[model samples]
Structure formats: structure tokens, C-alpha cells
Target: MADQIRPKWALVAHGGAGAISRGQLSPEQEVAYRDAMAVAADAGAAVLRAGGSAMDAVEAAIHLLEDDPLFNAGRGAAFTAEGRNELDASIMDGATLGAGAVAGVTTTRHPISAARAVIEGSTHVMLGGEGADAFARSQGLEQVDPSYFFTERRWLALEKGLARLGLPIPARPTGAPQDLSGKAALVHEEGKYGTVGVVALDAHGDVAAGTSTGGSSAKRWGRVGDSPIIGAGTYASNKGCAVSCTGAGEYFIRLGVAHEICALVRHKGLSLQAAADQVIQGELTALGGDGGVICVAPDGQMAWSFNTPGMYRARIADGEPLVVGVYKDET
Candidate 1:
């Protein structure tokens, strides 16, 4: 009954937040990234154009990013220290405070769908680890062979990152606590890359938010970061806005970035843009964390903010469904 608002409707996405610079990527890579982003943006916009729910548009857009190996979500997820792939994802519906999440799930074909199931299934606001995986099975979510997640590119990238950490190559010692100083530096060095995020305003004016990731490269077991957490990595609330973020997980967890943005809007009387900008440029930076986010307010306004050299981002509006991806300065 509340789904009849005719907001302008918008969609935004990010591939991943990291330190990608013009100097690092060839023109060819830039073109390919934009091409893929356009494809994803169009898919999302199409759903919105057809009077689909904001949830549908958000999921459609994110699903495109998930399937693309160019980004680090589902198919192209990074590897765990054990050389296995575990994916995490979450979704939120702004109108209801309903949310769902999955962690350490290796077999679900659509991690995001599992998250949505959790959002609608019960009164529980979150689920994790084996519990989340089991919920997926009970819901009849598609399952994939574990090997379907393997990616040589991601593996080799993590291996190189480990090498730069001054750790032994190829061995990644068993049961040894990693020396994180060097690894942290490497992570910071590549900290500008953003995560795959989606925010949508459907024809009915409802707002939805979603985020998915492979987590940090070579992350430890049970070391779940913010990606699958509602208030940290993503949040949606009809009272103000819907947000999805990508950045240093440690700082995001510390700051509660997503929920904090919504709170500033609901409590301080700040606009969605003002709250988001403040958090990204003020609080997050002060905490020594860097990254960016893609968001949409309930009014259908949109924004992207980052403190790093570049963020892989794209946007589509009601008028045009073009996908535009950028890695460096925006003119």
C-alpha cells in the first residue's frame, strides 16, 4: 500500500574499493571495467523502469557485478588463507528494517538471495557462519560446487600480496599467526578499491540496499568483516536513506559507517548527502581508514564519496541507463 510514491528513481554501484590509479591500469583495462559496469547498471535500471521493486533492482544490479570476474564478489572472490573460497553478502529493506546475511557460505549459488531470504523468513535480523548456510539450504537456494568459486587471478593476486608482505611464497605456513604489519601495509597500499554495492529507488518509492564481497585477501578463518553485516557494510531505512559501503573493514566496524550515516540523518537533521560526506571525509579518515561508498536517499537523490585515489563506481538515472565506470579523478 505504501509502494505508490513516484520518486525519480536511481541506481549506483561499485566494483570494489582499492588503490587503482591511472598509472596502474592501462586504457584497455579502464574500458573493460566501464563496459562491465554499464552492463550491470542497465540491468538494474531495467528492473526499475519496469515498475519493479527497489529490492528487485538492487539485486539485479548486484547479481550482474557478482557474475563478472572483473570485480571481486561471487565468481571472482578472493581466497581464504586455507586456499578455499567463502563468500559473504547482505541486504536491507529500508521500509521495514528487515535484513538478512550469510557468512562463511561456500555452496550457495546466490549469496544475496540467501540474505534476502533471511530478511523475509523470520523475526531474526541477522544470521551467520554455518547457521546462515543451513538457512540457505532450507530455503532451497541454488547450490554450487565449491570449485565453481576458484579463480586463478584472485589466487595469484593474493600470493603476490603475501610476497610483498615478506612472507614465504607459496607456503603460507599452516597454523601460524600471520605477521600483519606488512600485510596491513599492503592492504592499505591497495585500499582505494571499493566493494560491489547497490542502492535503488523503485517506481513505488521504496529503497533497498545490498553489498557483497570476498572479504580481505587471504583473510583468516572466521574473520568476518563488514560486508555481511547490516549496519557496518550496508543499511537501508525509509526514514532517510539506503547505503552500501566498501573500505577498510576494521575502521568500518569501529565507526559503524552505514548505520552511522542513517543516524546522522534521522537524529542530527542532516541531509543524506551531508551525513555521508561527513562520515567518509571526517570520521573515517580521522580513524586512518580510507575507501568510498554508493548510496541513494529515499527521495531518489544519489551520491558517491571516497577518500582514496580512485573508486570503481558507476551510476544510472531514470533518463538513461548507461553504465559509467571510473577509477581515477572525475574530470
Candidate 2:
């Protein structure tokens, strides 16, 4: 009976997850976040409504989110221990199991697009550092100076994170904001971890997933998180579902969070929601990790789960209104 009403197309997205809760933001901040998410979700859902491929829809959605400074992806990404913006992203096509990723990209304007470029143009599954940036440039994708990703908010966050770790802060990037006054209180540890991702089920019954991030604040030694790693931060399969995860990268990588959810749905016949809950609520929690995920299936099923106080998420399906969420209780 539930399947009888399933929509032909659906999409879901997340703007990272962690220790978020009610009152975490002021009225203005909440509105900004909600509006940003809606715009991104609508951009993706519009493609599916037009009979576009799931991969196209996923890419379209992430492109918008990556551009917006409200979420941590492209322009507003966090800083590393060296105070540089090192971005990572990945995308997967469920129907073909074709995937592409880029890690530690410092100059690509849109890492998600760089990832898509990899899948469509290259034989390699992943590219990193200067090579990844070079590939994006060769593809004619927009390239920015390293400091284009700088945000006063993120800079403040980096300073606070480093202070807590007793690490000496590096000098600011070349073209950074000159003033840093009165912004220290705004940077909280809980807000330092963030990523943006999307999953879509298109009219052709195909699914796809994509994720992008600036990685953990104040991270050192070229650490790459789960966002750029297939089957960890992102996984999709038309056989069951598509999953994009956000949280502590180490745990997500160990649990193979994204792939495990799809595996449970495909192999154990668990429902999309059940599989998501099992992986995020049960297995991930048992490991003492905190985070969340957004998922969508070709059958139009959609679900999200997070162990933290909140997760920034949204979803849309054919013949249904868009739904946006933040706090855990909003579930």
C-alpha cells in the first residue's frame, strides 16, 4: 500500500550534522539556513521533475549549495591547521556505479563539479591536491585564488579550534579580511564540522548521491575526511538506495556508513528508513560516533537519521511539498 503512493521522483539533502539543537541559532540565522537549503533542494528536484537523470539532479543541487556561503562546502568552508581551505567532494551514479572524487583541492571553485568531471572525463576514480586542481582547470571549470574561500566566520572558527588544541595559529591567507573584531564568540566547536550533500531518485528510476566539504577545522597533515571517499561519505545503487553521510569522518570511514545502509536495504531487504536508522542510530551510535545522513531510493522512499541534537536537512517528492529540518526533535 505504501509503495502504491510512492512518487516517481524524489530528492533529499543535508548541510552537515553534529551538536545542533533548538536555540542554536537566532531567528535570522535559522531563516537563512532554511532558505538556502530550500533553494538547493528545489534546484535538484526541478531536474528530476523534468525527467533528467538522477546524476544530473544530484549535481545541480550540490552546485547551488556549494556556491552558497551559508553552508560549509565551497566559499564558506572551514580552515585547516595551516589555515588553508582544503576541500573534498565525491559523486556516484547508482545505475552504473560510476563514481568520481577529489581530495584536498585548494583552487577548484566547485569541488562537486570537479568530482563530476572526474567521473565523466577521466579513468581515475579519485584525484588529489595539485593534480585535482589541474584537472579542474583543464576541464575549464572556474578556478579561484586560495583566499577566495576565506570567510571571517570560518577564520574565527579556525582560530578558536587551534587555541583549544594548543596549536599555534598560522598567519592568515593572502587576501584575507583585515579585521577580526568581535567575531570570536560566534565560532563554536559544534559548528566547526560541516558538509553539504544531495541524493536524488529521478523519473527513470535511477539514483545518485554527492557530498562536498571543507573538512574538520584545524586539521593537520593533509588529512582527508570521508566526504571524498566513496562508500564512506557517499554511496548510491539503483538496486536499493543512495546515501550521503555527514559526521565524524573517522567513524564514518570505519563503519562504511553510506555503503552499509545501501547494503542493508539491498541484501537484508530492510526499508530505506530502517536501513538508515540501523546504520546511524544503532551501529554508528554503538561506536560512540555522532552524526547523520540523508537517503533516497529509486522507489521514491526518503529518510534521514542523526544521533546528534540536530541535522540540517530537506526533502521533496513528486506530488508532495518540500520539508526542511534542523533540530533532532523536528524529526
Candidate 3:
């Protein structure tokens, strides 16, 4: 009898995508970001090594990023125009085509956990704002005061955004929405591109993807980004691939970048690498936007592509050691 090939598992993750120029980040800061990516990848790889589902692995990896203040997901989230935190997250199970998402939730400490709860515990695919926070509380997930999400670094970012717009700083930071109609909100920073995501293929050949973010800095009127939108920021399928995106949220949502990559792979018969490159480089670039994606195929093949100066990413495939990178040159 011929020897049967064993199924392989793979994992990939990204912090964000933007102009992470070499001259911008100090050696110490670069080491810190690379170490954080390694830790997140290790968390997911450990689950896959133990025969856990891809869903579990993705969630585990994202949870670590959310907890760490280094990435801009949970604890390190950016502030809105109102100088408050509003989080968004989404998760998908490729084997079952099940997805859950939460948007604009201010009190949920880990929005990704709440998103998973919606997938496994409820029939709804998405929940938003106070309703999402209510559902998260009912699920017994941890809840924190809105102030728990406050970080001085992010506060300064918001102030910088207002300054860029030539808007006067608010006398007191309140939750009231600001009128930002003609003002261009900054999505990318020199060092912090602003979201975190993961994609994983498990021992059973199932794939999963998830994304979490604080939306754009200095955003107003409850702006919700592509991170909580399934086809835009996160997608997974056993027959195609799993993808998670980070970049300009509006362009991502309008372009359906995540699903478009999978469609090109499924219908056009393009390899995972080709599909990802086309979308990140061709489609998104033409739309006058910048971002990045991390994708994993069913057979444990993986690709990470970005149209920016750099992206924080890590990957591990079948019997391979974990690889981490922060700049385009490293890849």
C-alpha cells in the first residue's frame, strides 16, 4: 500500500499594515514588536500541535494580541474623535461557514470573545454597540469600565489627529460625537498601523480567520470598520483559504478584499500567493488605499502580502519553525 500523506497545519498573524519605515522604529521598538508577533504565533501553533480546531487556534492567538498593549486591538486601541474607545471584532469557522461579529462595543474587554460567543451561542451573525455589550455580559465574558481601555499613547494619537485637521482640542474629553465631515482621519501611523488578526489551518484541514481593531483614530459618529464585517476583513473556507486584513477600513469594506482573494483562488484557479498579491497590490492599490493580508490554504500553504512599507507578521507551517517580520525587507 502507498504511504498516506498526513494532514498538515499552519498559522499566520498580523499586527497592522502601513508605512513602517526603517528610520521610524528604533531597534528596541522593532525587537518588541517582533517578539510580540512570535508570542502570538506560538499561541496558535500550540493549539494546532495539540489537535485543536482552527477556530480555537485563531481565537487563542488573537486573544494574546488583544491583551498585549503593543498591538492596537484591545488594550492598546486608539481613541475616537470623542476621545473614547470603541472596539470591533469578528471570527469565522471555515468548516461550518459560521461567523460572528461585534461592533462599536465600548465595555467588552475582549471583543473577539464576544464575537465567538455570538457564533457558537446565538443564531445572529452580528451584534453592535450597546446591544453587543449586553450580549457579551449575558455570555459571562469579562467586562471592563470604558476607562480600562484608555492608554496615554493612544490619547496622544487622537490629539495629533485633531491637530492635523486644525481642529481645536476639546476642553474636556467627552463621549459626544464630533463633526468630522470634510476632515480626513488618519488610519496609518509610522509605527502603529492599527489592528490585529490571525488565520489558521488545523490538523483536521479546517481553516479559520479573525480580526479585531479599535477602528480609525479620531473617528466620529460611531464609525465601524471592516474588522467586524465578515467578507471585508475576515473570511475562511475549507475549499478556498482563510484571510484576515488590516489597513484602510473604508477601502477594504468597499472592495470586499478578503472575499475577493478567496474568489480569485476558487474560480480563477490562482495559487494562494498569487491571489493575495493581486488583491493587496493590484485591486487595493488601484483604489488608492494601502493595507495587508495574511492567508492560509487548506494544504498548509500560507502567504502574507502588503502594499505598504511594512507589516508586523508571523507564520508557522507544518514542521517549520515560527517566522516573524516587521518590515518589507525582512520578508
Candidate 4:
């Protein structure tokens, strides 16, 4: 009977999480970030308002972000140490527990759409590298040259990373270092850490989540982060909620941040807000990982939490004005 009843819809999204201090951004830049959040939120909420599935809503929202160069997921993805871009994405449908993902992919115009194709067309849960690109082509997804991913801003970040390591700019893109311990920390601290994600609750009460990223700046050896890992960065369940995370991939994977929130709700009887806070504020902070997540519950409740100084995020529920913020203080 509960499943038969239509619920009010809600949608939420995040650009990324990190030390986004007030003085770091100009007034115009702040407005740009907030405006981007509102656009992303409106895109997804529009689908929900039209009685679309949560899966569709989440995908629609992420598409808008991926197209925007302001975020670090698709067009503006960070460059590897070798100055190349390798994109990753994942999507999940909570109603059926079906999911799809792609990693180390290049040339696929929209990695999220490829992920959706994998869910709808294949028996596999994920594909990577050349194989994923081939599949995307077969599905008729838009394809682009790898050069299309290049952005001057991300290239500068790579240069900064090399500088932090006391390494000279190589004559050629020799790829990143084998071990990027200190280097990765420098990239994150400089606010180059980013990802894009969305979660939605549809009129039918189903929840879905999706995430996309370009991996870490100056990363090497086909490194994959939490963005494309289903439970680590994205999860959804009709019985609980949908979660999309953006943070240090290793910590999120080890802590199972995304699924942990859903598990807390299903097994521990915690509300969506409490569950998200426990993971983002408690476990993640204790582990020294700075990031955040957007969550939407089956009951149309929404929650977002981050341990960092700021997270680019927005939320909208039925009949409510969009609420967008980039700093912790605003929320």
C-alpha cells in the first residue's frame, strides 16, 4: 500500500567538497558556483516534478554538471600527471538494485550515459579503459577525441602538483609519479579536489544516485577513485535512501561512506540526517578525509553533510524554493 502511494519528490546535488574558504573565491566566482548548483538542482527536480523515475532524474542532473566546465567531472576533469584526462562515472537504480559504472575511460563524451547503457544493455556491473570506450561506441553514445577533455585550468593544477613535488616540468608528459602520497595531499589542499553527483526521490518513492569524476589531479597508473565505485561513492535502495559522495577515494572506500549511510538507516534505525552526519562528520573526519555527500530518502527527506570547510551543494523539495550554498556556514 505504501508503494502504491505517490510521494512528494525531492532532489539534491553537489559539485565537490574541500577547503572552500570565503576569501578563496571572488564575489563573482561565488555567484557562479551558486548559480551552477541551482541549475543542477532544477534540472533533476524538473524530472521528478514531471513524474520521471529517480534514476532518470539523477542522470539528468549529473549531465548538466558534466557539461559545465566549472566542475571537475567531465569537460573540466583534472589532468593526470602526464597531462591526460581519464573520466569515471557510475549510476544506480534503487528500486531494482541495478547499477553500472565505467572507469579509466577516455573519448566517451558522457561517461554517465555510458554507465546507464551498461546498466540497460549488459549483464556486467562495470567496464574500464579501452573496453568501456568500445562499449560506449556500440551503444551510440557521443564520442570525442581525448584532446577534447583538455582544459587550461586543470593543466595548471598539474603544473602546481609537479611544483609541489620539487620536480621540473618534463619535456614530455611522462605520466605521474608512481607514488603520489605528498603530491595528492597538496592537490587536495589547494582545492583541486572535486567530483559531481546527484540523488533523487521520485513520485513513486524510488530513490537513485549517480556520481562522476576525472580522478585526482596528477594521478597516475589508471588510478580510480570512489566516484565510480558503487557502494563507496554511490548507493541507492528503495527501502532506505540514495547517497552520492565526493571526497578522498581511499578513505571513502575504506569507510564505505555511501552505503554506510543507507545501512545505518535500514539497520540502525537512524534518520537520514543522523546517518549522513555520522559518516561525514564522525567517521570521515576521524579518518582525516575531507568531503561531502547528498542524500534523498524514500520518504522525500533530504540531507547533505561534509567535513570540509565547504561543499558546493543544493537541494529542492516539492513546492519549496531551491536552497543552494557553497560554504558550511550557509547551511
Candidate closest to the true structure, highest TM-score: 2
Could you tell which candidate, 1 or 2, scores higher by lDDT?
Answer: 2
Best by lDDT: 2
State each model's CA lDDT, in order. 0.76, 0.89, 0.86, 0.85
Model 1, runs deviating above 4 Å: 1-7, 164-194, 320-323
| Ten-residue stretch with the least lDDT total in model 1 | 180-189
TM-score to native of every candidate shown: 0.88, 0.96, 0.92, 0.92
State the lDDT of candidate 1 residue by residue for 174-236, as single tens digits.
342333332111222244133688888876668899998877776764778888888999999
| Preferred candidate (TM-score higher): 1 or 4 | 4
Better of 1 and 2 by TM-score: 2
For residues 1-331, could you state the per-residue lDDT of candidate 4 as single tens digits? 1533434898999999987888887676777778888998999998999999899998899998887777888877887776778999999999999999999888898899999999998999899999999999999999987766655566777788889977665343333233333212222232656899999988887899999998898887788999999999999998888999998888999998999999999899798999999999999999988899999889877899998888899999887789998888986
For every candidate, C-alpha RMSD to the true structure in Å: 5.9, 2.2, 5.4, 5.3
Tens-place lDDT digits, model 3, residues 1-331? 1114434789999999887878777676787788889999999999999999999999999998888766778877887887778999999998998999999999999999999999988999999999999999999999987766766566777888889988766543444324322111222254334799999999888999999998888888898889999999999988789999999989999999999998888889898999999998999999998999999988777899998989999999767888999888886
Model 4: how far is 231 from its true place, Å?
Answer: 0.6
Candidate 4 ranges with C-alpha deviation above 4 Å: 1-7, 167-192
Pairs in clash, predicted candidate 3: none
Ranking by lDDT: 2, 3, 4, 1
